[model samples]
Target: MRKSSFMRISKSISLIIFLFVCNNLQAQNQSYSTNSKSDFWRNVQFGGGLGLGFGSGYTDISITPSAIYNFDQYFSLGLGAQYTYIKQKNNYASNLYGGSIIGLFNPINEIQLSVELEELRVNINLDGSNSNSQDFWNTGLFLGAGYRSGNVTIGARYNVLQDDSKNVYSDAFMPFVRVYF
Candidate 1:
């Protein structure tokens, strides 16, 4: 009877150990599967802005390219590079190049709030010849809000650093569009 009781106890302990090991393996497999779904490239977005404007004797063209990483469904961070050219009737032309750091927050399904910090190099050619030019740096902070639909976003921003005496833009309001893929 003593030997029978010992065998029964040993069998029960072995069953419990086997069950514990199986459960742990299953949990590890689930964790790995979840991580694989959100790989690095899967969370990346690519898009930018293209702008063209023409008036009586003025022309403006701009191109910007950007990349963003989605930290989750509600937040994203991005970086962008910009190039712009402007020509006026009076033989005044300007070339602007810059880079920006962007942040976005989505508090609801269709609303987005954005902020951008930018550093730009401005080259102004007083003569149409382009040989006589001046170079300077301009920095701006822009605050914006927009509506997003599908892969497109439309927004308007106001520049916090706009100064009529020193800044290139006489107006502080700018409109923008962004597409994502």
Candidate 2:
């Protein structure tokens, strides 16, 4: 046989082996799913955050909703959406909308590690004038470790993309809470 023919045969064998391994792993996963009694809703979580603030000539409101899926005892993935509105005296206002992805890892009881990636569209009127509004996108990544008890999780995360001027967050460190249902 020619060198090219031998090479072709080797590539074909490698492809077959890769496909076989993938098929085997997928079959095992399917078996686990079929053997489990819990339905889809039983393995899912829903929770988020809400905020309201009122002060001198200013008011703020925020709402976030999230859903998560528990793949197993060790790891979970989630998605969330956020909306915030801020209004001040003299027609000043800002509106923000965004979405985020969350990942959690639990190595032991009551301890958790988390990472989040988010993007937001910020519309702001810097001088309280509706005629001069600006819009921009803000992206952030946060990493945290926390303790969980029952349905509540409390943790502190640091924003990896925090900027002194452009970012809206006052500081890099922020606290979070999650209630799963």
Candidate 3:
């Protein structure tokens, strides 16, 4: 082969090899991004709250379970369930069971905001000694604000759907602590 011809052939082969390598690298990077997206469960978190109180002739107990799916670092949506029981010496006994849906937002790393809607069934037995009972359904919408750190938050919420004369909670405002894993 002539010197110029040999040199041209070598240069062409080198360019082809370089282009092939670059194409394969780009394909690999695309594949990696796809695999990363499939890791949906990694963004899910589970948590809730529990409470118990007892005193002379009075008892209260509560349990809540919740799960949230983080869409990104800034937002999440969750579902929750709650059950509560209360007994007063001779006056009454009550059971509250409920479900809720909540939306959470983090405008900054340390501040969080939330909105929650809840539906509850309240059942009460009058005069602990008799079978006289009352049952009703209650609904509440709450707006909340909190301070957040890692997987924990401390917050307060105000119920937009509260009645002054008759409500499960003593006040329209309530405080909370939340933790998730």
Candidate 4:
């Protein structure tokens, strides 16, 4: 082929190859978007907390496990289950089992505000007396605020539905330290 015609053919081939690559990339982009709609598991995060307290003839143990689905970077909703056992030697023992639904909001990168509604079933029995037992259901609404750093958040929560005498929690204010992956 002549020099000018050969150069022209090479340039045309380069343009065609560029066009094909661009079209292929665009198709891949569309495919990713479609698959992202069904990728619910990717947005889910799992986390939980464990607690223990011990004293002379007294013991308290709690287990909580939770899962949250991140709607975006700023908002998430999750469900948590809690099991707590308290023993006071020669006095009484209590078993508390509950579940809570929580909604979390991060208005800023360093702050988190959460609202949780919990329903618990409490059972109390005396050490030596089997006939005298108490079983009831209690509900608590907790509003919490925290300071966030990386995956850890330290904060306090106030229970709006706390009772002075018949309460599962000893106090209305509880502090928590949480870490999430």
Question: Cα RMSD (Å) per model?
Answer: 7.5, 10.1, 8.2, 8.4
15-111: candidate 2 lDDT, tens digit per residue:
9999999999999999888767466668899999899999999999999999999989889899999999998877678899999999999898699
lDDT of 4 at 33: 88
Cα TM-score per model: 0.73, 0.75, 0.77, 0.77
Error of 4 at 33 (Å): 12
lDDT of 1: 0.88
Ranking by lDDT: 3, 4, 2, 1
Candidate 4 is scored at a TM of 0.77
lDDT of 4 by residue, 102-150 (tens): 9999999899999999999999998888998889999999999999998
- Lowest lDDT block of 10, candidate 3: 126-135
Predictions in order: lDDT: 0.88, 0.89, 0.93, 0.92
Decide which is better by lDDT, 3 or 4: 3
* Model 3's TM-score against the true structure: 0.77
Off by over 4 Å in 1: 1-38, 55-57, 128-132
Ten-residue stretch with the least lDDT total in model 1: 125-134
Best by lDDT: 3
Question: In model 2, which regions exceed 4 Å deviation?
Answer: 1-38, 127-132
Q: Which is the winner by lDDT between candidate 2 and candidate 4?
A: 4
After superposing candidate 3, which stretches have Cα over 4 Å from the reference? Answer: 1-38, 128-132
Model 4 clash pairs are: none
